[model samples]
Structures are given as structure tokens and as C-alpha cells.
Target: MEIFMETPTAANGGNPGKKKRSWKKLLLWLFLLILLFSLVFHFTSSLLFRKTEAGHLKFITPTVAQFRHEIAVRGDISSSENQDIKCRVRSTGGVMITWVVDEGTEVKEGDTIAVLDNSTLIDSLDAQQIKVAQSEAEVKAAENNLLTAKIAKEEYENGSYKVNLQKLVSAQIKAKEERDRLAEYLQHSKILYEKGFVTQSQLEADIFSLKQAELTLRAAELDIYVLKEYTHNKQTNNYESDIKTADANLSSKKSVHLQNETKLKDIQQQIEYCTVKSPSDGKVLYVNETNRFGSSEFLVCQGAMVRERQTFLRLPNSNKLQVTADIHEGKISYVKVGQSVQVHTDATGDKIIQGTVIKVDENPQPTNHWMGNVKEYRVTIRLENPEGVLPGMTAETKILVEESQDEKLMIPTHSVFEHGGKYYCIEKKPDGTLTPITVELGHSNDKMVIVTSGGLTEKTQLVAAAFENRELISLPELAAGETSSPTIRPKNEEISGDFNGENSNSSSPQAGMKPDGEMGSDGPKFGAGEMGQNTGMPGEIPAGMNGMRPGGPRPGGLRPGGMRPGGPRPEMDKMEQNGEMSAGMGENGFPPGMDGMTPDGPKPGMGMRPGRPRP
Candidate 1:
């Protein structure tokens, strides 16, 4: 019994040792399996991450942020209301300024502002004075002639006409008396003859004397009639005509004299106008113009000819200030009347002046052809407090177009690209795989764009720029029946074909797909003149196809221009020989058939193949 108990003790002790060893072995195997699994998992994850990041050098995590939509433009400060002092001279060819007040000089009303050349006015005044004197002499002569005509008329009517009538009446009375005496004498002689005391000759003489007296009486009566009727009328008519002619001459002379006097007054007034006077009290500001080459277009110096009504100086109100800026046509839609602006002037350094947009011009500023076709609209902003700000200072304006009241998801403008007329961005998956996801966009500025929707979150990571990594990315497949490609033609362009499915008869299913299809980095492919199949990603035009020339249909039902998608056609040789083909050369500077053989010898790496001859 004692021997058996000792043996049992030994067996129990061995069992404990073996159990400890077995437990240790199982733990070690578990550790080794865990280590191996961990290594495999790490290697897989690293490979996936590297593959996703192979083409991308930049990445961004979407975040909720605020971006201000604003437009910045540089402009000049000016006064809202300006009292322009214009040139008011009316001289021909404009008047030349002999003297002018210096710019920025403050003056009171009625002060002499400028003086013009008055020499011409002085000469005109002298000539006008001579004309006035001559007209005055003519007027005096007309007055004397009028008086003499009136006196002559009165004298002829009262003195000459009355005296002639009286003389005729007296002659008639004497002739009547003589006729009566002779009649009486004849009667006495007849009585004496009856008594036979007188001889017959004496009676005859008495009768003849009576007859002569009667004839004398008739002549006197006729003279009286002629003097009273015909002679008086003729004399009155002559006097009246003389009076009318003299009156008309006097009126004409007076009119001429008045005209000369008016001219003389005008000349004197112009002489006074030669000196310009200030209409109001203000500081003078010259209205000079600067040309494109930084030279003054209109200088307000002495001896410069000023045009009529041209604004040569201005009197601006310093209290009312404003800024004028030009907004480009692309961003002008954001600007409106009454919008707020922040102005920073060079003179007021670091100080921001608050202003309001008071005016927006309807028309664009005129631009030169060499300046490019960029239309800019003028915007006027009135300063609220114009203290310490002067006119003509340079200023930069920041116009606040829009601002976000709530934080929203946003990304850089370059992170999004257009595909199939929809915007997309490369999204990084949790497993480190990249995929293109559609995104809805809202208002954008120069730096950032607002993401309206697309299931994006704050933790979403996107490629910083999509176009820069488009080659390494796998683009989305096109929808059913969707064909998108560009057309290519030769330099002469006699034939045409559309890579989008028009006039295409290629048997290959992948022709004209991606832009750089088949013609990879090794240059263009010349595959027995057969229509090539594109091996590049779909939906994007590649750089290789950009240099393709047009060709007509050929054997095996090639597309309209025999020219395939991958490269040019063999018919190009015949076209080149006939001078009908003038396509642009590739980087090697020679066509396929004309390679290597040039007037200057063989080109680098472009020597003719061993079996081919130069065309």
C-alpha cells in the first residue's frame, strides 16, 4: 500500500507539468495566428489606400462654413454734386485764355477767374465807332433836307400861288374898263356922222378900237382861269412830293443809325466779357482729361484755346462725397441700387468708409479694341460720412453681393467639374476607394462654392481639383443610347465625319470613345490603316484625337473620311503626292509617308523604315 501511494503522487506531479506545457503551447499558437492576421490586414489596407491616392495629390474635407459673395474693384473718389465753371465766350474759333487763376485757389463770388485775349474786341470796337459817326452825319443831313422841303412847300402855297391869282384879276378889271370907254366913243362918233359934221374915216377908226378892246378883255379872263386851276394844282403836287421824299429819307437814315449804335454797344459788351468772373464762392478744380498713355488731353494753361461751353473748371462740394467704380459684366448682375459697400481710399489708408450704391449705369463703358472685349458698368457709391476725404483720391470698393446667415457645407470651386451637364466631385469612401458623386451647387465666388445637396456631410473628403486628375480616375459609364464625341477634319477639310455616330461604319465597338483612346503616351498608332478601337475611358475627348485630320471613306467600310480614330489613312500618301492634302504635322514635324526625308536631311528618330520609300 505505501509503494502504490508514492507512485500515484509521482503521476499527479507529471500530469500538472504536462498540463502547464499544453496551456503554454496553445497560447503561443493563438498569438502567432493573431500576428499573421494583423499583418495581412495591414498590407491589404495599405494597398487600397495607395491605389486610391495614386492619381490624387490634394484632398479636402467638406465643412460647414460661411463664404461671402463679393466683388472687388478699384475706383476714384469724387463729389456727388459739382458746380462746373464752363467757358462762356462766343468768339469764332473759340477764345484763347490770356490769364487764368491757379487751380485749388479759393475765391469769392464776382472775383475775376480768367482773362481772355481782348485785342480782337478792341479793334472791332474802333471800326464800329467810325461807322456810328458816319451814320450820325447822314441822319443830320436828312433832318436839314426835311426842313427845307417843308419851307419850300409853304412858300409856294401861300406866296407864289396867291400873288399870281391877284395879278390876273387886276388885268381882267382894266380890260373891262377899256372896252366900256371904246364903246362909248363909238356911239358918239355915230351921232356926229348923222349930223354930217364928222368924216366917214373917223367913224371907222372908233369901231376898230372897240373891237381891239373886246379881244383884250377875253385874254385877261383866260389868264385868270389858268392861274387859279392848273397852275395852283401843279405847284401843290410838287411841294407834297418833296415833303414825302424828305420824310422817307430821314426814316431810312434813322434806322441805319440805330443799327450802327446797336453794333457798337455789342462790341463794347464783348470787350467787357473778355474777363470772366466767378459765379459762386468755392475752390477751383480744373476739369482736365488724362489719355491712355498718362498724358493730359486738355490742359487749362494760358494760351490754350477753350471751346464754347466746355467745362474747364469745377467747384465741388466737399461735404457730399462719392466713389465711382467699374463692375465687370459677368458680376454686374449681383449689384443693385441701394446696396451697401465698403470703401478704402489711398489717402485715408486703412480706414473703411461706409457707402451706398446710388447709381448703376445702364450702358457699359466704351473700350478700345486692344483692351479686349470685357464690358464694365459704372457704379456710383455715395459716402455716408465724407469727412477728411478729398476728391480725386484712389479708392478700392468691396461690394457685398450676398452673405450666408447660416453655416452650410461648402467646397473649393476647383473641386467640382461638369460631366453630362451635371456637376460632380471625386468622393473618398471609408474603405479608401474613390468614386464620382453628383452634387448640387448654389451661389459661388472666386474661392468657394456652396453645396446645396448631394448627401454630403462634414466628414466627406473630395478631390481638390477634378480636371487635374481626370486621366487617372475611372469615369462613370454613359447612359443607354448616349454618344458624346468631337469631330475632326483635315486642314483643307473637304470631307467630314462625326465621332458621335454620324457616318461611322467602323466594325470596332469602341471607336472615338475617350479622347486619348489607343494613342497613348507612345504617340500616334499606324495600324495597317485599319479603323482603331479606343481603349481609354469614355465620355471625354482625349488630347490625341485633337490633331486628327478628315478623310473620305475607304475599303472595309471605313467612316466617311477613310481616316480612322487612332491615326491617319494610307490614302494620305496619294493625297500628299497630288498636293490635295496639307494637314498639320505632328510633334515629329512630318506626315507618315513623308517621314525622315526632308530637304535638310533625316529628322531625329524619324528616319524612313527599312522597307518603306519616301513619298
Candidate 2:
């Protein structure tokens, strides 16, 4: 045509941008229709084919079986009788270990098991020796002094006292003789006067001499008396006192020497104790003990400080073996003395040693703070054949409580659940329906329990783990004194999104919405009215949404009923008051429709809700 063929752009419209926009609009409508169709199909499928809670449970058929009733416990193999080689040294601070025999080394009675650092003890011995020597010298000096004292006492008593008395007696005798001679002269003078041969003065002189002689005799007698009565007694007393003092001094010196000798002996004994020797013929076990924290101080290692009387090694009687195991309080009641046991020691490999329970503790073992209220009792087991077993080895013991001679109906312990003072088991009917039945249990071990009375047939199938689905199934009425309620929920309501149970729904007003109302027949209704109006069809902002607008306010500016830019939304407050925005609402407090949008922007699922960006 002059008709020059219209340009391809001109045939449709002058504006290519408008045509492209229309195509995009058509594509958007197509996508929305498909999404809506999928939603409807999904809802229809869910309603038609509902899942049953019992479908996930595993079922087991009850059968007659025989199983042993036993209590299994782990223990350590030890000796019934042991000679503890302990540190016998008496040191204020601990002694340092110099050398120690390797653990598990067999040795004879006289073999040295350990050696301590005796350098300090050696120094003490040397010092004690010096003290002994000093004490000995002092004792010798004391002995010499005592001898001198005794000799002085003896000389005073036997020689000096007697000699002095003899001298005094001789003087007294001489005075008496002088007195007698003077008296005779006086008598002669008187005779001469009478004969006129001498003058009167001479006679007077004789008389005076006689009187002086008499005085001298009197003095001599007094001296003799004084010597016998006073001087002799005093000398004897002094000698006796000297003897007593010497004896006392000698005794004190001897006591001091004895004390020093005792100290020297103690030091020597301590030095001997530094080298620990095996007391019997057995394997040596080093006492590497641990604390409450399970960490050891390596007490038997070289250079380690060993306390006085702390056990550093042990010599176990290999001929007599035993195991010490701890039984829990729940199972301890079933264990009794004389019960047979099978012990499997880690050291003896696969060998099973037969043993008998010898002792059962009446009281529980010391409780650990970290273990809570659990209590355990100690049990001693004497092994019958323990040839290959060694001390300090880990062993597992299985104590035979009882055995069933006849076959009985047995089920797993987990298959039974306690409801309200009664045990229950989920029984499957022939019509594919599951129902709860009361079960009377008898004896039980760790794994299986015997059903005493249940009226269940051999072909009856029961849930393997009834306790897991107890809350979901309809259970029988509570027993007479039971107060707990059965938490049976409707099938459709179980899928409703309340993380916490009924308590959370009742506590918050808004969260307790009727399931049918919140989730309509259409299945999870999502629209702009529930989210923000501006959130959908981007360009033109509509006003019916229940939250704050994404942009500032609508064109008319802020209204009295409108929420501020960053303030709380009035609709949100209403939702909170009505309990609609409670914890039952998803993880975030918003409605399910608004779950796709966040404060910052849209989440990964549906990007921008339909339209162009606003200018």
C-alpha cells in the first residue's frame, strides 16, 4: 500500500513500552491464577486423605518366650586380701620418691619395691650422731664428777672426820696431864712453907699455877665434848649429802644420754623405711590414686611427694580374687548373698569366671553431688576360678536373680505405659483400629516384662512403644484416686500451630482463636487486608490493611485514627487485646498472611507483591 508496509512498531502501537507493560500484566495474572489453583488443590487433598496418629507407631505380636532375670553391673577386679606397702617414714613435709619398681612386676618377699630420697634423713642421722656423741661426753664428765663427790664423802667420813677427832683427844689428854702436875707442885709448896724452906710469895705462885692447870683441864674436856657431839655429826652429814647429790647427777646424765640414743635410733629406722620392700610374694601394684575429679597426683612416680602412711604400693594375694561392684538402689533389693554370678574381666579377655556373692552392703555408697538422687550399693563377689584375672582390671558381673522354667507371654518394657495408677498397652483390632487395654505385669528385667493377666491372644498385635503415643490415643477413664486429665486432641486441631500446649492458649486472650475461624475452609487465607494495604499492588496505596503502612502516610496526611510513622499500629493493638497476636500466632507475633513480609522487606518466598514501585 503506499502502502509501504507499516513499520512493525507502528502496526501494534506507537509506544512499544505500553505493549510490553500489558504483556507483563497478563503474565502476572496468569501466575496468580495458577498459585490460587495450587492452594485449592492442596487444601482438597489434605481434607480427603487425613493422616492417623497410629500410622506411625510400630506394632508387635505377643508370644510365649523364656528369658533370664539378671542384674548386670560393671566392677573392678581386686584381691580379697592385700598387703598395703605404705610410706612408713615420719616426715612433717612429705618425702620425695627417688625410685619405684614398675607396676605389675612380680617380686619376692625381700625385694625392694620403692626408694625415697633419703638425703634429708641422712643429714638428720648425722646430726643425731653428733648429739649422741656430745651426750656421751657429757655423761662421762658427769660420771667423773659423781666419782669425785663420792670420794670426798668417803674421805670426810673415814679419814678427815676421824683424824680431826683423834687430834682433839690428844690435846685434851696433854691439858689433863699439865693440870695434874701443877696440882702436885702446889701441894709441895704448901709442905715447904710448913718446913720454912720457901717464902710465902713462891707458895702463892704455885697455887696460881695449880688454878690455871685446873682451868686448862676444864677447857680440854669441853673441846673433846664439842668434837664428839657437833663436829663429827656435821662432817658425816656433809659426806652423805655429797653422795646423794652425786647419785642424782649421774642419773640425770644417764637420762639425757638415753634420750639422745633414742633420737639416733629413730633416725636410723626412718632411713630404713625410705626403702620400701615387698612383704610377700606377689605382683607389685603402684598406688596411682585419683581424686574426686578423676585426676591422679601420680603418688608412686619418681620425684613425687609421698605422705606419711599413704599407700604407695600394694601386694595382692593372687590366689584369692574378688570383684567389687556397685548395684543401683532400684535393683539392689533383688540381689542377695550366696547368689551365683558370671564375671567377665577386661584383663582375662573372653574368659567367664564363675563367682558367688559374698557380701551385700546394707547402706548405699557415698552419693556424688553431680549424680543427683541416684543411690548405689556395694556388693562383694568371690570368684571361683580366677586364674587369669589380675587386680585393678575392669570386670562386668551378671548376677542371676531368677530364671523361668516355663514359657510365658513376654513383652518389651517400653511397650507398656502408666496412665492413671494403671498400666496400658495399645492393642490393634482386626478391623485396623487401635485401642488401649489394661495389662497386669509380673516380673521384669532390663529389657522384657512378663504379662501376668491381660486376656490378650497369641496373635494379638500391640504397639511397640505405647508410651510415646499415649497422649494422642483415646485412653480409659482415670482410676478412683487419679486426678490427671487425658490430653486427647482432635485430628484437625493437632495441626494447628501452638508450640506450647493448652496452657499457653489460655494465658493469652488473642491466641485462643477458633481453629475454623482462623484457618477458614479455603485454607490459610492471605490477603492485603490482614497485612498492610501498601504491601500489595505497589503503586497505589489502599487503606484496608490491619497494620502500619510501609511508606509515610496516605495523601491526606495523618488522621486521628492513623498510626504514626514509627509508632504502634492501632490494628495491632486491637489484635493484641483480642489475643489474636499471641504466642499461638507463628514464631513472630504477626498473622500467617503477614509472615511473608518483615519490617525490613519481603522474605525469600514471594518477592514484591504485584506492581510497579511508587514514585
Task: List the global CA lDDT of all models.
Answer: 0.71, 0.71
lDDT of 1 at 383: 97
Tens digits of per-residue lDDT for model 2 on 1-615? 265766546766677787699999999999999999999999876544323556666889777887678888999888999999889998888999999999999999899889998999899899989989988998898888888888887887788778877887887788889888988888888999999988999999888888888888888788888878998888778777877887888888889899999989998999999888888899998778776545675657889998999988999998898999988665677789999999996667888899999999998887655543456789999999999888989899999998889898888777776665467888888886778888887776656777888887678889887877666468765421232222211111122223222222111122222222222212222222222333454323322222354433321112311243423567877977986544323335444445544564532221143232211
In candidate 2, where is summed lDDT lowest over 10 consecutive residues?
485-494
Superposed by TM-score, candidate 1 places the C-alpha of residue 424 at a distance from the truth, in angstroms, of: 11
Against the true structure, what is each candidate's TM-score? 0.58, 0.66
Number of backbone clashes in candidate 1: 9
Model 2, which residues run further than 4 Å from truth? 1-63, 293-298, 412-441, 452-615
Q: How close is candidate 2 to the true structure, as a TM-score?
A: 0.66
Q: TM-score: which candidate is best?
A: 2
